[model samples]
Target: MKNYFIVVEGLDGSGKTTAINTITKILNNNGIKDIILTREPGGTPIAEKLRKLIKYNIKGDEITNKTELLMLYAARVQLIEKVIKPALEKGKWVIGDRHDLSSQAYQSGGRNINQKLITYLSNMVIGKFKPTLTLYLDLPPKIGLKRILSRRKIDRIEKEQLSFFVRTRARYLEIASTDSSIITIDANQNLKQVQHEIYKILNQWLKIYK
Candidate 1:
């Protein structure tokens, strides 16, 4: 079977996890075989450890943005080699919850790190292995924040000031504008409506693109 790498990206509370679950079930019902759903920063063992460090804000006391970027790449490098690439090689449909694009949006956009440098670093680390398609669940940061707050405990990144999240979300939109592979899906709608839109996109992917 041909390989498919699908990525789902959005700010917190954009319903990414729910979308993935729904997509998985829908795909299975459609008899789409060889699907593997995964998330970044925690796909492999080593990256999961790094994911804990970054999310828990364990290194916050002295963590510079540069260090944060490096640590993220460190986790990414390992995941691409250990999880992503291997799955693709086996002709499995790999669905990523978040990927390098998250780094660009959060680190470069939220932290105001250099974009040229960020691009260089991303290329250096990721090379030609970008996700074939990404579903960008777009919604207002305030709404997203509210959803996140009601759903679960906040992590280090989540504990950041409101200003940071607002900027980060803008960055996600900004990057989505420049990438053809990214399909922006309206996320402000009710859950069923959002799922309907996602289902439409998935149907297109499976029928036309596949």
Candidate 2:
């Protein structure tokens, strides 16, 4: 079977990590053994360093919008060129916790960067490559933030105002609406229900792809 790159996308607290784990287990049980799980902005060593800067902003220096956008692509390209593409070339399936759509939502919507710029950067960095499947867990920003706050310290991006997330979420929905490969799942439901939906989707996909 051809290798598949699956991505799980959601707000900070929408349980994407959990969903990735469940999806991994589902694939393993279904006989897909050659798999790698990775997250954006930190999959490789250099990218991990960039992740710290982007996520924590430990320097406390205000990062400009353009700088932030460039840093994100820097980390992403490193991950893709060094890790994701290589693994795919080796016929290993990859499950990503987040992917390119994130920049569209966070950078373009949250930071109000122009979509054209984002698209241009994306073309330069990744060209026509895209995930085989993307699962977007959709939830209200307030609830998502509350969930995030309950778990751990908020990161720099997570510290943004509610309105920022609202705009981000709106962009995610808008993008998902136009993309057939992107699957939107209601993340407001109970944990088990969300997982069930994901499993169902994966199972159907497997029937066709595997």
Candidate 3:
């Protein structure tokens, strides 16, 4: 059987990292031997380097939407080649922190880039290997922004205004609504409650995978 490709997505600071980590530990404890937790724009060596360059502001030149979109696909290509495909071939669970939906959200919704262009570019780079199960941690844009602000300096994407995040979120919901594979979970709940919801989703997915 092909291994599962599970992608967790949301606006920045939706407790994605914590949820991912908790899922990792839970899967390990459950004796899911071949589970691998990885993320986009930084999974492989080359992609990680590119991630830093794209996210961090340069001294003078700005990272435009087109360049940002291209770089994300570039990283995704390397990740698919070096990490995602190989691991699934070896029959391991690949839990991704983010994936192509992020491109759709940030580049298209936030940056006002063209969706068709982004889709075409992503397909050329990563092909049709979309996520089998996408867990969208849903939280209000204001809440996410506040959480993000408490953590680190704002990157180009992070610095985007409240209006941008709202659109991104609306787009996420719109897409997920039409897709059964993508599951939306409330992220504004407390951390433990959020983790519980995740565990519930994983349990349901495991039934299909098993």
Candidate 4:
């Protein structure tokens, strides 16, 4: 079987975890068991450290938009070089919680950074390497924020104004529309419905690989 790299993307509370879990179960049921789960700005030690810095203001210093974007690419390069590529080379299917798309949405859209610079960095750092499939859970920013707030303390990025996420979601949809690899899911539905959609979409996608 050919190894596949899958990425789950969404706002803070768009049910990416549930989608990942459902996808993993679907793959396992299909007799595909050599799978590795990871997340970005994470998945490696250095990346995890960068993840912390990116997600939280541990220090009093304010992270500039360009700096944040560069840090994300740095962490991403580390993850791809140290973890994702190695797993793929070993024939392990990798399911990621988030990936480059997050940088495009969050840093480029939310932070109002120049998209050209982001694209250039993307090309320079990871080149053409990307996920085989990306599941983007789409939902309203208010709804996502409400759901996340009820669950736990919000992170630095999560604490951004509602307008920020609005822009982020806009960018997500814009990019998803253009990218055939990205499949958008309506996450405003109930959990069961969302999972059903995810299962249905993933199951169909798996048929191609099989």
Candidate 5:
């Protein structure tokens, strides 16, 4: 059995979670049941703790950009090592809600960190391991913000200014443009339309896999 690592990436309220669920269902319907569904920033125990710190200011002080970036990588490496890698070795497919691309968009793009530095960090942590397929759900920050605000309370990262998300989205597009492993989907359409597009992509990919 060939293991697959599938990553779903997008800004908040881009419907990544819903898309992952739908993808999982489709894969299961296809008789791919050895699947591990997870999310970044907190997949493992230690990573979950780091996620809380990163998501909320539990210490009552602002987390500097560098600190936030490092902590995110810390959580990510932990998840990758303790869960994702092992699952893959066991021949289980892993579906990720978010992945390293989020850090590139949010930390390097939104926070104005150097891209080369981020690349170095990524190489150090994840090395040559990359997702088998990445689905990037693209949408405007204005619309995504509206959808999020209406759905739930904003977290620390979500509370950033609209400009932050704009920068992040731009970075996401830039990275996706150069990465052959990434497939960008326009998420501005209706829910059914978006899911249909995702299904189409997955169906094509699975056909090739066979």
Candidate 6:
């Protein structure tokens, strides 16, 4: 079986965890059992430290947008080199909770960073590397925030104003519209409905790969 690098992209509380779990089970049921699950800014010891700083202000210091962006790329490079690439080389299907698209949406879109810098850093760090299939869970920022707020204490990025996520979603949609590898799923629907859509899409996608 061909190894695949699959990524799940979405806002906070957009059901990415559930989506990843469902995808894992589906893959297992289909005999694709050699799979590895990982998340952005994590999956490695050094990267995990960066994930903490990225998700929380440990020293209560303001993390500049540029600083945050650089840290994200640092963690991403570590993950790709140490975890994702090696797993794929070993014929393991890698399922990621988030990836580069998150930076495009959250940093470039939400933080208003220049896209050129992002493109430059992307080329510099991991040129031409991307997921084979990206499942983007689309939903309104308000709804997503509501869901997360009701469940647990929000993180640093999650504490951003509503406008930030609005721009982030817009960027997500904008990119997904033109990227053939990305499949957008409406997360506003009920759980059953959302899972049904994922199932249908994944089944069809698997056929193509086969």
Evaluated with TM-score, which candidate comes out highest? Answer: 6
For candidate 3, give the lDDT of residue 95: 88
Candidate 2's TM-score = 0.98
**Model 2 C-alpha lDDT per residue in residues 18-89, reported as the tens digit of each score:** 899999999999989999988988999999999998988757588888998999999999999999999999
TM-score of each: 0.95, 0.98, 0.94, 0.98, 0.97, 0.98
The Cα error of candidate 1 at residue 89, in Å, is: 0.6
Q: Over the stretch 93-161, how does candidate 1's per-residue lDDT look in tens digits? A: 788899999988999889999988889998998887798889999988888889888968988787788
Model 1 regions lying over 4 Å from their true place: none
In terms of lDDT, model 3 sits at 0.86
**What is the per-residue lDDT of model 3 for residues 1-210, given as tens digits with 9 covering 90 to 100?**
446788899998898898888777767776776887788789888999999989885889888779888888889889988988899988898889999999888788888898899888877877788888898999999999899888777786788789999989988888889989899999999998999988888877777775
Better-scoring candidate (lDDT), 2 or 4: 2
Better of 4 and 6 by TM-score: 6
Q: Give the Å error, residue 133, model 5.
A: 0.3
Off by over 4 Å in 4: none
Alpha carbon deviation, residue 72, candidate 4 (Å): 0.7
Candidate 3 RMSD to the real structure: 1.4
